[model samples]
Target: MSYHNKVVLVTGGGTGIGRATALLLAERGAIVAVNYSRSAAEAEETVQAIQQFGGQAIAIRADVSSNEEVVTMIKHIVKRFGTIDYLVNNASITRYIAMEDLDAVTEEAWDDLFAVNVKGMFNCARAAAPYLKAGKGAIVNVGSIAGMTGKGSSLPYAVSKAAVHGLTKSLAQALAPDVRVTGVAPGAVNTRWWAGKEEQMRALIRHLPLDRISAPEEIAALIAAVLEQPSMTGQILTIDNGQTL
Candidate 1:
C-alpha cells in the first residue's frame, strides 16, 4: 500500500502488535503517531526505530480511555501531521481467571480491562471522527478471536472485544462514504500475554490446524492490507489459522 505522507495513529504502539503495525505503516512512508499509556520508554524505542529506518514517527502518551487525553492525542497528531488517515485501536488489557474464582476477577479487573479495551477505542474513535471524516481515513480495530466464539481470556476481556466487533460495524455504518472501520481478530498471538507456561502454550498450539501461534508482524501485514482495500469496510477479518473453524 502506498502510505506516502499518510498520518496513522496506533494506540499501545509501544510494543507487540501495535508496535508492529506502527512500524509497517512507517515503512510504507506513513507518518506514524505512536500512542502509549504508560510505556514511555517503549514508545520512544518504537519511534526511534522508525527514525533509524528513515521513517517519520512521534511518540505520544495518552490514556486512550480518557476523552480529554484522546482529544489531546488527536490534536497533537493533527498539529504534527496535518490529519489522521488511519487509526489502529490496538490498546487492550486482560486478566485470566476461572469462573469459580470470582475473587480473582475483581471489580477492578473488569473496570481496567473495559477501560482500556472497549472505552479506550471508543474515546479515540470519538475524538478522531472529525479528522478522519475530513481525510477519508480508515480505522482498524484489534479484536480477538475470543470475542467471536468463546472465552479466550477472562470474561471481561472477551466481552470487551465483542464490543469492539460491534463498534467496528457501527462505526463503519456511521462513517460510510467518508471514513471506514473494520476489525482484525487474531487468535493465539505470541506476545507478552503468553509469557510463561511454554508447555501449555505448546499444547494449545498443537490443536490449531496450522499448529502455531501468530506473530505480531503477521498481524501487521493484515492491517496493511486492510488499509489498502478501499472497498472493504465493517468486516472482522479473523486470523486464527482455521482454529475457530
Candidate 2:
C-alpha cells in the first residue's frame, strides 16, 4: 500500500492504458479520479470496479484539451481528496490517415491531435502541479515508441507524443525540487486502441527483440514502479522490449 491515502488523477481512464493504470493504482490503495471524455458509462464502470475492490474512486468527465474543464476537474478532485499525490497524463488521440490523403491530415486534424495529445497533457500538468508539489507527488506521462521512431498511425500522433517526452523533461527540471516528472514510452501494447490492426502491430513487434507485444498491465507495472521510486525523474522509460535498439 505504498499509495495508501494518496490521490491520483488519470486522464482518459475510461479505456486502454489509462484504464489499466487507474485500476491498478486503486487496487494498490490510491484513491483514483477516473477522467474520461465522451465515455461516462465506461468511466463509471471503472469506478464501480474500484469500489467493488474496496478502493476509493470517482468518475470525472472532462475533455482534457479544455483548460477550463481541466482546472475545474482538478479543483473538484482536490476538494474531495484534499490533495493530489500523482497525475498520469494518459489521454491521447490518433487517426489512421494515409500520407497520400493530405487533405485527411488537415489543419483540423493536426489541431485536434495536438489539442488532446499535447495540450491536454500540458493543461493537466499545469492544473495539478500545485497540489502535486504540495504532496511531493509524481507525474507519469504516457508517451509512445512512435515518438522515438517513425511508427505511428499518423504523423501528428508521433509528433505530439514526441512533444510529450520533451514536456516530461522540461517539467521535471522546473519542478524537481518539489515534484517528480517522468514519461513511459510503451511499444505496441495490446489494447482496444489497436484491436482491429493486430496484423500491422504484429509486424511492428516482430522487429523488437522480444518478438511480442506488451500487455497493458506490463506497461502499468513500469508506471507503478515510476510512481514508487522518488529518485527517478525527468526520464522517459521505454517499455518497448528493446525496440529502440
Candidate 3:
C-alpha cells in the first residue's frame, strides 16, 4: 500500500524504532501520529523534524497499557485525520534482571512488563480495529527475538514478547480480509534501550554473524516493507543481525 496521505499512529514513537518508523513513514507522505507515554519532548521533536521536512505529523500522549488511553488515542487520531490507515504497536517495557535471578523477577516486574508489552499491544489493536477494518489498513506489532529464543534481558520480558507474537497472529485472524496484522521481531539495535547495558550489547555483537548491531532505521525499513507487502499477514519477520543463528 502506498504511504502517501496515509494516517498512521505509532505508539512509543518518541525514540528508537518507533521514532525511526515515524520519520520514515512521514517522509513517504503518511500523516503520522507519534504517540508517547512520557517522552513528550522526544515525541514533539519527532513532529518538529517531520514538519521541517514538509511532512505532516503530531505528537500524542497516551499510555498504551491503559485500555481507556489507547481507545481515546485512536479516537483522537481518527477525529483529527478523518480516518485511520495504519497502526504500529511499538510501545513496550522491560526489566533488566538476569534470567536466572528468579528472586529479582518480582511479581511487580512480571506485571509491569506484561502490562505494557503484551496487554498494551492488545489494547491498541482492539481500540484501532474498527477504524483499520473500515479503511482496509494494516497493523504492525513490534515483537522481540527474545520471544522465539526464550532468552533476553529478563524472563518476564521474553515471555511478554512471546505473548506479543501470539497476539499478532490472533489479531491477524480476527482482523482478516479487511485489515492485515503482522509483526517484526528484532534483536539488539543501537538505541537508548542499550544505555548502561552497552557492555552487554558489545558482547552480544561479537557473537552475531553479522558482527554488528542493527540500526533503528534498518528495522524501520523492514517495518515499512512489511506494511507495504500486500500478501503478507500473520507472520513475524526477524532482523536480528544473525543473533539467533
Candidate 4:
C-alpha cells in the first residue's frame, strides 16, 4: 500500500536508529508519531525535521514500559491521526557491564533492561493492536544481534532481546491475519547509544565484514523495506555487517 498519509508510531524516536526510522518513514509519505522517553528535545527536533520536509509528524513523550502511558499515547495518536497504520517498537535500553562481571549485573539492572526492551514492546503492541488490526497494519520491532548470539553489552541485554525475538514470533501468531508482527536485529551502529565506547566501537569496526559499522539510515532503510513486504511476519531480519558470521 502507498505510504501516503499512513500513520506510523515509532517508539524511542528521538535519536539513533529510532530517529532515523522516523525520518525516513515520514519522508516517504507516512504521518509519523515520534515517541521519546527522556529525549524530548531530540524528539521535537525529529518532528521539526519531518515537518520541514513537508511530512506530517508529532513528538510524543511517553514511556513505553508504562502500560497506562502507552495506552494514553495510543489514544492520543488515534485521536489525532484517526488511525494507526504501523507500529515500530524501537524503544530499548542496555548496560555496558562486561559479560564476565556478574557483580555488576544486578537485579535492578536486569529489571530495567527487560522493562524497556521486552515489556515496553509488549505494552505498545497490546495497546496498538486493535488500531493496527482495524487498518490491517503491521509492527516492526527493533531487536539486537546479541539476542541471537547470546553476546552483547551485558548478559541481561542479550536476554532481553532474545525475549523480544520470541515475543515477535508469538505476537505474530496471536495477532495473525490481522496485524502482522516482525523485527530487525541490527548490530553495532554509530549512534549516541555508544556514549562512552567510541574507541571500542572504532576498534570493533575493523573486524566487521563490511569494514564499517552499520549506519542508522542503513538499518532504517531495512526497516522500511520490511514494512513493504506483505508476506513477512514473525521473522527477525539481521543487519550486523556479518559480525555474527
Candidate 5:
C-alpha cells in the first residue's frame, strides 16, 4: 500500500529500533505516532525530527504493559489520524543476567519481562485490531533470535520472545485476509540494551558471519520491508547475521 498517507503506530518509539522505525516510516510519507513509556524527551525529539523533515508525526505516552493504556493510545491515534494503517509492536524489556544464575531469574522478573515483551504486544494488537482490519493494515512484531535458540540474557527474556513469535503466527491466522501479521527476530543489536556488555557483544559477533552487530536502523528498514509485502504473513524473518548458524 502507499505509505504517503498511511497512519502508523510504533510502540516504544522513543529510542533504538523503535525510534529508527518511526523516523524511517515518517520519511517514507507515513504519519507516525511515536509511543513512549518514560522516554518522553527522546520521543519528543523523534517527533520533532520527523516534523522538521516535513513529515507528519506525534509523541504519545503509554505503558504497553497495561491494556487500558494501550487501548487509550490507539484511540488517540485514530482520533488524530482518522484511521490506522500499521502497528509496530517493538516495545520490549530484558535484564542482563547469566543463564547460570538460576536464582537471579525471579518470578517477579519473569512476570515483568513477559508483561512488556509478550503481553504488551497482544495488548496493542488487540486494541488496534478493529482499526487495522478496517484499513487492511499490517503488523510487524519485533521478536528475538534468543526466542529461536533460547540463547538470550535470561530465560525469561527468551521465553517472552518465543511467545511473541507464536503470537505473530496466531494473529496472522486469526486476522487473516485482512490485516497481515509478521515478525522479525534479530540477533544482537548495538543499542542501549547492549550497553555494559561491549566485550561480550564483540565476542559474540566475532563468530557471526557478518562479524558485526545489527544497527537499529537496519532492523527498522527490514521491518518496513516486511510490512510492505501485502501477501506475506505468519512468517518470522530472522536478521541475526547468521549468528544462529
Candidate 6:
C-alpha cells in the first residue's frame, strides 16, 4: 500500500531499525508515531528530524511489555491521527550473558527478555488489532536470526526471538485478509545494542559470508518492502549478510 498520509506506529522507534524505518516511512508521507519506553531523548530527536524534513511525526512513550500501556498508546495514536494504518513491533530487550552460562541466565533474565521481546510484541498487536483490521493495515514484527540459528547474546534472547517469529505467523493467520502480518529477522546491525561488543561484532563480520554487517537502513528498506508487497504475509524475511550461512 502507498505510505502517503498513512499513520504508522513504530515501537522502539528512537534508534536502530525502528528509527530508520520511521524516518523512511515519514519521508514517504507517513505520519509516524515514534514509541519509546526509555529513550525519550532519542525518540524526540527522531521526531524533530522528521519535522525538519517537512514530514509529520510525534514521539510517544509506552512500555510495550505493559498491555495497558500499549492499549493506551494505540488509543492515543488513533485519537491524534484519526486512524491507524500500520504498526511496527520493534521494541525488544536482551541480556548479554553467554549461552552456556546457565547460571547467568537467571529467572529474572528470562522474564525480562520475554516480557519485552515476545510479550511486548503481542501487547502491541493485540491492542492495535481492531484499528488495524478496520483500516486494513499491516503489521511487521522485528525478529532476529538468533531465533533460527539458536545462538545470540543469550539463550533467553534467542528463545524470545523464536517466540516472536511464532507470534508473527500466528497473527498473520489470525488477522488474515484484512491486516497482513509479517516479520524481518536481522542478524547483526551497528546499533547501540552492540555497544561495548565491538570486538565480538568484528569477529562475527569476518565469519559472515558477506564479510560485513547490515546497516539499520538496509533492514528498514526491507521492512518497507515487506509492508508494501501486497501478496506477502506470514513470512519471516532474513537479512543477515549471510551470517547464518
* Candidate 2 per-residue lDDT over residues 1-245, each given as its tens digit: 37898999999998888889999999899999999999899899999999998999999999999999999999999999898999999988888887456667878878999999989999999999999998899999999988889667787788888999999999999888899999999988888877788788878877889888888888888899998897899999988888788
Query: lDDT tens digits, residues 1-245, model 4?
Result: 46899999999999999999999999899999999999999999999999998999999989988999999999999999899999999999988889998898899998999999999999999999998999888999999999999999899999999999999999999999998899999999889877788999989999999889988999999999989898999999999999999
TM-score of every prediction relative to native: 0.97, 0.95, 0.98, 0.98, 0.98, 0.98
Question: In model 1, what is the error at residue 52, expressed in angstroms?
Answer: 0.6
What TM value does model 5 have? 0.98
Candidate 4: residue pairs that collide: none
Q: Tell me how candidate 3 scores on lDDT.
A: 0.93
Which portions of model 2 show Cα errors greater than 4 Å?
99-103
TM-score of 6: 0.98
lDDT of 6 by residue, 78-141 (tens): 9999888899999998888988889888999988999999999999988888989998899999
Which residue pairs in model 5 clash with each other? Answer: none
Pairs that collide, model 2? none
233: Cα error in model 1, Å: 1.1
With a 3 Å backbone cut-off (N, CA, C), the pairs that clash in candidate 6 are none
Q: After superposition, how far is residue 143 of candidate 5 from its true place, in Å?
A: 0.2
lDDT of 3 by residue, 55-125 (tens): 99999999988999988988899889898889999998888888898888898998899999989999988
lDDT, model 4:
0.94
The 10-residue segment of model 5 with minimum total lDDT is 193-202
Give stretches of model 1 more than 4 Å off: none
lDDT of 4 at 148: 98
For residues 102-178, what per-residue lDDT tens digits would candidate 1 score against the true structure? 57888898888888898899899888999899988899999999898857667778888899999899989988989
Q: Model 3 residue 237 lDDT?
A: 95
CA lDDT of each prediction against the hidden true structure: 0.90, 0.90, 0.93, 0.94, 0.93, 0.93
Residue 119 lDDT in model 3?
A: 90
Q: What is the lDDT, from 0 to 100, of the residue 234 in candidate 4? A: 98
The 10 consecutive residues of candidate 2 with the worst lDDT sum are 97-106
